[model samples]
Target: MAQGNERKSKLLGSGDIVVSFEFFPPKTEKMEETLWSSISRLAPLRPEFVSVTYGAGGSTRERTHATVTRLLRETDLKPAAHLTCVDASKEEVDAVARAYWDAGVRHIVALRGDPAQGAGTKYEPHPGGYTNAADLVAGLKKIANFEISVAGYPETHPESPSVEADIENLKAKVDAGADRIITQFGFDNAHFLRYLERARAAGIWVPISPGIVPIHNFKQVSGFAKRAGATVPSWLARRFEGLEDDPATTHLVAAAAATEQVMDLVDEGIKKFHFYTLNRADLVYAICHLLGLRSARTDASANAA
Candidate 1:
């Protein structure tokens, strides 16, 4: 039960902690290079699994499938394909789930995606689509014994009618066979703690991994957080206020902010972490280093090399 400050010396001293990374499908050639580079850098750490996001309304469907399939074929990392209920009907979504199963991907990040207009917009479920994450999780279970992970909102989803309703929705997802809950990114550790408490009260005993978003582009991230209904503490804003033009300084600051956030969560009894890597590896790698994870071995690092 050592606090983060107390455990600082233990950070990166071992490689036993569990971690997972999130990456979105690349849309361009150059971005693809950057992503593989990041993948190369982080793969040695041997993350529990890496997930590729499905864009709103399945906008990135093809790309997502390609990326995950590539991981299955080329990389040793386990890949989780994100599936969402938004633009597609139940049968269509089922087809995608089956495709992933056929592709040898057993993990799925089941989600009820933001409105096609994006988060903060009014959500209108497609007429014949799975209406929410709960239904989607149930559907995936029917398709396969997929290891399903569903989104949890520590600060509550912007479109949720109330926090109680949000928790109820989360409970439904769990009851429908969600194995893990990865939260929306939040800066305040207290919010995460409270959310976990509430989830426990609601009868969810699954692992609730805190989602950590390193502040690579603070302004852009802050805007996204707001739209996603995640609160950005004023202190976090001040941490990146004047470093807009300084990428080097920004990375250093980003590392510190992320490290501090995770350390605090560790102090609050959270053991697992899910990082939204944003297609960059160094900062997340550093944070994991600070969390006591390391490259698996000479052979693995050589392969990722």
Candidate 2:
């Protein structure tokens, strides 16, 4: 893979890559400051759109609304709000979608979110609420013309009975009018490629974006991967070995590991990506630069001054 760097460079020079980013709303004032700072740093790269995550059971509904609305009012970037079918009646969920529409947000990431109790717990849909993501997508389409994106799992979802069932579930979402699918974050590129092939064979023709998470903290990411049912390859674990106590060295290794993953995907002719930024920008910004994405705003400023 290291030997393909030159080829990756050549491909990036052709300028067809499209990227988006995902962020979680902040829970406090200090965290809010950090979130905006990260947003400011990344906005110059001009992502296709940036998405704000909805918390479990709609816990962060108000915060998510505030963050997304701020992006609409303050930035040139397009914002996609995540809406879920958990713990709320259909009327209530529809109201939120209406609010987003009135606020000038036209894109949504519709999801059948995790159970409010926790991840491993069984998901019990609210009485009279949309039963699942497919249902939610249908409801949102009825409300307005939203460019909707839904989740995909390269490794089948933990709660799903089988891979076949998971694919069927995805098909249902597409049938209900989802515009695209962004898969769960994964460490192994082979798994993602295989999943894409399976999705295409099943007649899902929409674009499927591979989700990338640059590991800022390997231990924390490992815990998340376990709950999300994504496998962390053993070789990936060894890459961060002995760097647990060294933040500086860990950042370098994290950047390199993520860069390699995206470049390898590029070598496979994947042109679109969605990054789970975890509310920081340095690593993602660095990776975008390595992919030959320079800030158009930066270049304009230099020319003007």
Which candidate should be chosen as best, given lDDT against the real structure? Answer: 2
- Tens-digit per-residue lDDT, 67-115, candidate 2: 9999999999999999999999999999999999999999999999988
Q: How do the predictions measure up, each by TM-score?
A: 0.94, 0.96
Q: By summed lDDT, which 10 consecutive residues of candidate 2 come out lowest?
A: 1-10
Model 2 has a clash total of 0
Each candidate's lDDT (Cα)? Answer: 0.90, 0.93
| RMSD for each of the candidates | 2.7, 1.6
Clashes of each: 1, 0
Query: How far is 290's C-alpha from truth in model 1 (Å)?
Result: 1.3
What ranges in model 1 sit over 4 Å off?
Answer: 1-12, 298-305
> Once model 2 is optimally superposed onto the true structure by TM-score, how far is the C-alpha of residue 13 displaced, in angstroms?
2.7
